[model samples]
Target chain A: MFLSFCDGNGSALGWAVLITVVLGVAGCAKNYVVLLPNDDGTTGKVAVAGREGVTLLEKGREGAAIGGPAGKTFMVSDEQIAEDFGAALAASPQKPVSYLLYFKAGTDVLTPESQADLPEILAEIQRRPAPDISVIGHTDTMGDAAENARLGLVRARSTAETISQLGGSIISPDRISIESHGEKNLRVSTPDNTDEPRNRRVEVTVR
Target chain B: MLAMRLLVLAGAFSLVVNVSSAEDAVIGYVKTVDGDAVVLVAGKATQAEPGTPLQRGNVLKTGKPGSMGVTLKDNTVMSLGPDTELVVDEYLYSPSDGDLKLGASMRRGSLNYISGVIAKLKPEGVSLKTPAGNIGIRGTHFLVTVEAKD
Candidate 1:
C-alpha cells in the first residue's frame, strides 16, 4: 500500500512525520467507504490518500485495506464493508417486514415444516402494533392452470384460518389479504405436471 | 475524581445540545428494536426506542443479539442486524422539484434495504458507503451483510 504513494519527491522529515501519524491512526481500524453503481453500468468514484500517495478506487473493486501515502487508508467494496463516515450529529422508525411460507402436494395444507413454523409466524404478526398480512398461495405443476389457480386461493384461505385461530381477534378479516398464483408462479422451474414440493407454497408478508 | 468526571460530562452534554440545535432534523423513526440498540448523537449513546426520530449524522449501533428497523420519511425501510453501526450523512427528498439524495455509511453487520419514494424517483440519488466500498442501488430490495471485525 505504501508503494502506491511513494513518488520519491518528499523530504525525509515529511516522510517521517507522515509515517508516524499513519502508524498512530492505523493502530485502530477506521475504514472509509463509498458506494459505487451496480451492474447496470451506473457509476461512482472512491478515493483515498495516505502519507505518500492516493488511490482512486477502480470500478468493481471492494475491501478493508490500509496503505497509501498516509498508510492509514483502507478501502473496500459494498460486497462487504464497514466504516465510520463522519462526526457525531443528533439523530433519530417504524419499517415494514415481509415473510414467506410454503405447502404440501395436491392439498391446501401447509407442508409439515411450515405447519410447525406457524407459531413463530403468528408471534411475529402479534408483535407488530398494527400488522397487515398479505398471504398468497401457489401450487406446483400437477394440474390444469385454472384448477391450480383455484387451489392457490384455497390454500391461502386455509393459512388465513390458521392465523385467525392463533391470533384470535387480533388477526382481523379486514387486515388479512389473500391471493393466489396457482402454478402461475412456480418456486421451482419445472415441466407441466411436475410435482415439485418446493413450488407448492404460500407467501405471507406482514407489514 | 468523581466530581471532576461529572464536570467533564456536563461540559460535553452542553456541547451536544449546542450541536444538535444547529443541524439535527428528523428524517425517519425506529419502527422496531430487538435486543439492544442505541442512537449515537453528538458522541452520546442513548438507548433507542421505537419511534425515535432519526436525524442527519446520527450513528446507529446495535449490540449482539439486537436488531433495529427504521422507516425514512420517503418510506425507505432499513433493518440493522446484530453488531452494526450506521451513520446517516445526508438526505434530501422533494418529489415535485425532482430533488432526492441519500448518503450513509455502514461500519459493520447486516442491513436490509427496501427502496422508497426517493429511490423510485431517482435511483442515482442513493448511496451507501462501507469500508469495503460503496453500494449503488438499482433494485427495490437489497440485503447486505458485513461481518464483525476483530
Candidate 2:
C-alpha cells in the first residue's frame, strides 16, 4: 500500500506535492478573498482591486455602495436636493399668504404683471429660511373641467419645481408640496358659468 | 347687415392653429405667471429697462453668462434658466400655425417661462431647450434653471 502511494515517478510526484501544498496555502480557508495571477504576462487578480461580494442601493441617479469586503460604504445625498424635495410638504397646513401672485392657465411661469409685487413675494419666502413653501395651483371654470383640474395640480407642482431651480435657498423643492384646487376649492366661487380670471391662480403658502 | 357683419368680425374670438409644425423650432410651456409674464428680473430684461415692453419674438441676447428673458405679446414674461438655449421659430396670435414664433436658448442659468395663449395650445409648438435636449410641452408649464458650465 505504501509502494502504491509512491508508485508515481518520483520527480513528478514531488512536483505534484509542491503544487498541492502551494495551492492549499494560497487559497483562503473561508470568508476570505485571494488574489490569483493572469496569463497575458500582466498581473491580473494579484494586482486587481475587487470586492469579494457587494450590494448597492440606488435612488434616482444616485446610488449607495455597500456590503463589501470593506465596512465603509459610499453614499451620495445632496442637502440641496433633500431640501429641494422637502420644500413645503413637510409643513403644517395654512391659508393663502397674499393675492399678488398669479398662476398661468396651464403652466408655472411667473408673469411680468406681478413684477410690481414680486419683491414682496420673494421677501416673504426669504424670511421663512427653513420654512417649507407649498405652492398650490387652482383653476376656475374657464377651460375643460378635468383638464383644468389637472392643470391646477401641474401648475402647482411646476411652480414648486421652478422655485427649486431658482432657489436662493428660500425654499427647497424637497420641502415643498405643490397642490391643485381644480375648481374644487375656490377662493371666489363662480358656480354655474363664470369665467373670472381671479379664480385661476397659484398660491405660495408658508409653513 | 354690413355694419353688423363688421362688428361680428371684430368681436369674434379667432381659433389658434398650429403653424410650421414641421419646423425644428418649438416653443416652451409657461412656468409661472407674475402679472402676465413668466420669468422676471433676469439679466436680459434689466438691459431693456424696468418698464420695457417685452415682446414674444424679442430675444434676451446676452453676451455674458446666464442672461435671457422673453415677453409674450399678451404681456406675459419669462426668464431663461441657465445652460439653456432656444429660438422663437414661429408664433400665431389667431391660434393658426405660423402667426408668431419665439425661440431663445439658455446657454447657462435658470429659465422662468410664463404662459400666455401659446401654452394653452398644448403641443410640440412649445418646446423647452435643455442640456440633454428639448422638453416637449404637454400644457403643463414651468421655469427651467440650469447650472452654467465653464
Each model's DockQ score: 0.05, 0.03
Error of 1 at B115 (Å): 1.1
Query: Candidates' lDDT values, in order?
Result: 0.65, 0.42
Best by DockQ: 1
lDDT of 1 by residue, A7-45 (tens): 222444466457647875343333332333433564434
Q: What's the C-alpha lDDT at position A172 in model 2?
A: 52
Q: What would the per-residue lDDT of candidate 1 be over residues B1-150, giving only the tens digit for each residue?
A: 999999999999999998776457567767677778899888999998765767888899988777788777666778787778999798886553566888888878667666666776777788777765566554354444544466
TM-score of each: 0.41, 0.30
RMSD of 2: 21.0
| Model 1 ranges with Cα > 4 A deviation | A1-207, B1-22, B148-150
Output the worst ten-in-a-row residue range by lDDT, candidate 1 chain B. B138-147
Candidate 1, A133: how far from true, in Å?
A: 19
